[model samples]
Target: MESLQALQDFIKTKDNFRNFVNSSEVPSVCKTEPCMLGVDEAGRGPVLGPMVYGVAYCPLSQTSVLKDLGCADSKALTEEKRDDIFRKMLTEEASLNNVGWAAEIISPNYISNSMYRRAKHSLNEVSMNSAIDLIKKVAESGANITEVYVDTVGPPEKYQAKLSEIYPNYKITVAKKADSIYPIVSAASIVAKVTRDHALKVWQFKEGLEMTHAEFGSGYPGDPLTKKFIREQVDYVFGYPMLVRFSWSTAELMLQDKAATCTFEEIDDELPKKKVKSISSFFSVKSEDGAMKRKRHKFFEERYLSMDNAFE
Candidate 1:
């Protein structure tokens, strides 16, 4: 998006539960010169809002432009600084000529569904797939990408090997804190972090909560506003709105305490089905023994009342 308002407008129109992408046009110089792309994510730990994966690419010769734009460890930068850098990416002549970026917003509902399915898909898989998709999309748009740097989602060596296997020609480096070490990855982090911040800022609750993101805070369990939202906003049958990630333990535990308990019939195809007695067995009368029956209540006993077979 060219501006924060434009990003908010775009997010408002989409189905909140579905994943979507937004990207800038690949600069002509990027297509002609060998380029490097970096990948990073935001909102991975939050119980609310979408997780965003962003990729930033530029010609290898123009890496200096990233430094000029003040790209650094995104986590260390204030929210205002990230927003300013992103705005510069939109307006600055040097940045526009050299840098291209893309982001995929992975919705909380999509994440919950992935993790809750019978054959569960972990969050790491969802994250890696999003990163791969963004990189491929950049390449398909004719960026001459020769190297990829990634902030690790899980184990660095394993993730690096996986990306290398998929893009044999491209050099891939996946490591912890790559956002701090690589300027391109830092730019990607800014893109992802800014997108996620705006996503929550403009969140429209399809469940009709009549509330704003401010009311829910940052979606971290430690945030008092978020904790209050989780404690108070609950549906007995369906649980919380799509804004909350149902698969997160924070959401799951809160829902368990506040919502109605629901059970489903579980079928196992591998186990042999046992033939059981009919439903009538539950009501069948057994032969009475000489043993004493249950005592009558005091009220009945005081009246010398007795229970007998009405039909007899």
Candidate 2:
């Protein structure tokens, strides 16, 4: 109860926060012993809330400690179960003496800004960078990190190579389903999932929505409640509050069709040019009726179905 209250109180104190972190105080736990660390993330797909990255570490020889605590794939556990495990990690001396953890919550507003930047940083880059930062933080805090395991959705070769290049002293392995296979990764997953769940649970809407997060559902685009919120709670001009990732196509399409079109920046006046009789300009520019009528050539179309548009 004290830990949960402390978390909520920390959440409430930030007024202009874009990104924030929660970290352990580098407990004197096995400080001189080599350790293994794991990294995982949650809420990457949700469009309505902050995404969280978490890392957990413990002495290399204390693998049994985590096993005894029932650290398993977070997806396989109920929310209540995950919460119980995390709470145990906080309150139990055996667990606390062997484990240390940290988390970073990347705000939706920050995600939207990165995606909409002039140079446009892709979400994958943003996520990878966050993971790297967390691992680096753990290592720099005097943890003798000898190995790292990461859970990934993309191919593992590139991510493994990057981390290995930076921390060659550590054995870095990036793999799909790692959270299920690795106890440390599973611990990280629990931390991430619980943090994300609570973040949405205690969300304080700056825009003053009268509904709870339960009413908005899980924030997945397919969730009927989330779809309803995106479609019905729109602000028309400002769109949904900053809680929503404005760059998501779900929100973009909604704004394009249902709300006034909005742009982030101002543009200079159009350049003067001699009138030409070219016919392709009609296909390239907006029509006189203010509609984009040119259908993309059937063969030369975008072949992917992903929202990470910043990545080219």
Candidate 3:
């Protein structure tokens, strides 16, 4: 029995070791060719927060190291785990450089349109521009970048066109799930999410908003709490705070409601005498058959009757 138990323990340990080895093995998806950059964005849907765009670059030689770092899609990881991995990539990994573009206080009205539209107009543009800028800087410093992959916000073709216009020298590929397919984009996503989350926390505290049980996770328009807060702020006439985006539909709704409540009156230099036409004379008209047809309209009478009743 003791010998059997020892054998079982040895097998279990060996199996565990094998599992670790498999987990640590670099993913085979990364191209062996040198020079690829990954790009992604976050906070595109948030009603209260800024849109964040991120970009990360990795040389071909370090692709295996990044894969071994367990880099995957940021959406697959918890906030804590993402932060941990992001920090590890930044410090321990030599090939990755992550950068972010944040647009603060984007209006709720903008969110009513498609998120992809907003991302394309704002975050995507900023991120791509910044990424190109970084690539140019790196190239000037003698670093060669052969290719870039962006997790497309809008159609893949649109991103491809934009990147082509921006960076004519390098090859750019825009795909729907580049974050999952490319480790560099995943790394950028991790950094972007972490940065945005931190910014949201700081904004919450600064705005005197309670974060506890707030359910304001990311503050997207879909969040009930965000909608409620928007309605309350607008209804309370908080004077369009800087934290709130004036371009959002929430703000427009509030403005419309305010407009509707205002009373309007006209001023005149002189009062005109009321003209009254006899109902019988007004209704008397000749028909096609030459017989007088009397048509009595009750709408005016009913309105006058209601006014009389109110006065009484």
Candidate 4:
């Protein structure tokens, strides 16, 4: 395990647009006793900084150790309280014996790239995959994981089903407020929230913004400082720095209204037809009113499919 300062320094060294993981050595007790793992995330709503998915595992019988460390509902805890709990998790002998944790930091640029790709990937998919990967990493690190708990915002049944399918041997529970209901999940939430807070604090803008995190305040769209940054700190050609998620509506709409307009060529999803067909089609499909109607492929016609003017 790294000291808090070491973790922050490590995060600062990485490229702002890439994803990375930080993990502790698996506890000796975890390999011998049946363990429960909890997963949760933070910063999903923030337009600034990285979203963090965190997983924490401990022996099923030693959950009381977490309580002693002050692990509870992370959202209910103050920043100082959360930091104290995390500090104990790093330094306390009892916690070191029973608990192990890992966090994946999903960068804002990565989120934007995934959503803006030719075949768009939704934020839900990104969040799910990050959680799954953390679980896999913990299992591979020699934890005898038998139960898994996840806190999620969307419908739990589908998420639970997906996790159950992936790890049939383990008992899986995906709930709306698992962080508050489960101690292990609360621990995971603390890990995620603390990591996200530090990530923003240590953020070094490659685009050379002179202001610090305090100037930008929280990354929520409603924050006055964040709104000011988005409104005033746009580049005419490249838009905001990597810290801002371009795919987010808050950033996209601001860029559209404030920056120079850029129109990209439309994506072509079909193969080009031969020139020979073009000459025949020009003369063959004229209506009685002298409007040209392009002939459709037999396969499309049979299915009653018509071309759509995407631009219109």
**Model 3 agreement with the true structure over 1-312: per-residue lDDT tens digits:** 112233223323431111110001112222243567666767765657555555565566666756666678989988778766655543423333222111122222343332346354554454455555544554444445677887887689987997788789888988998899888778767656765565455443334555532455457777788777666655344444444555566666776775345545655425685777787776567778978665545985666665457668
lDDT of 1 by residue, 1-312 (tens): 567788789888888889999888888899899999999999999988899999999999988889998999889999999998887776546345589999999999999999999999999999999999999999999999999999998899999999999999999999999999999999999999998999999998888788987799998888999999888888998899999999999989988888999877666755798888799765555557764454557997777666663335
Best by lDDT: 1
Per-residue error for 14 in candidate 2, Å, reads 2.7
Clashing pairs in 3: 107-245, 108-248, 108-249, 109-248, 109-249
Instruction: Put the candidates in lDDT order, highest first.
Output: 1, 4, 2, 3
lDDT of 2 at 312: 69
What's every prediction's RMSD, in angstroms? 15.0, 14.1, 21.0, 9.6
State candidate 4's TM-score.
Answer: 0.84
Task: Estimate the overall C-alpha local distance difference test score of candidate 3.
Answer: 0.55
Worst 10 residues of 1 by lDDT: 303-312
State each model's CA lDDT, in order: 0.90, 0.83, 0.55, 0.88
List residue ranges in candidate 4 displaced over 4 A: 92-97, 266-312
Error of 2 at 132 (Å): 0.9
**Which model is ahead, 2 or 3, in terms of TM-score?**
2
User: Candidate 2 — which residues are off by over 4 angstroms?
Assistant: 15-17, 92-97, 263-267, 270-312
lDDT of 1: 0.90
- Model 2: colliding residue pairs: none
Q: Candidate 1 vs candidate 4: which has greater lDDT?
A: 1
lDDT of 4 by residue, 1-312 (tens): 446787788888888879999887888889889999999999999888789999988999998888888888889999999987776666556345478999999999899999999998889999999999999999998999999999975799999999999999999999998999999999999999988888899999888887888999789999999999898889998889888988889998998898999878765636585445655555676677978676677987786666574335
lDDT for 227 in candidate 1 is 90
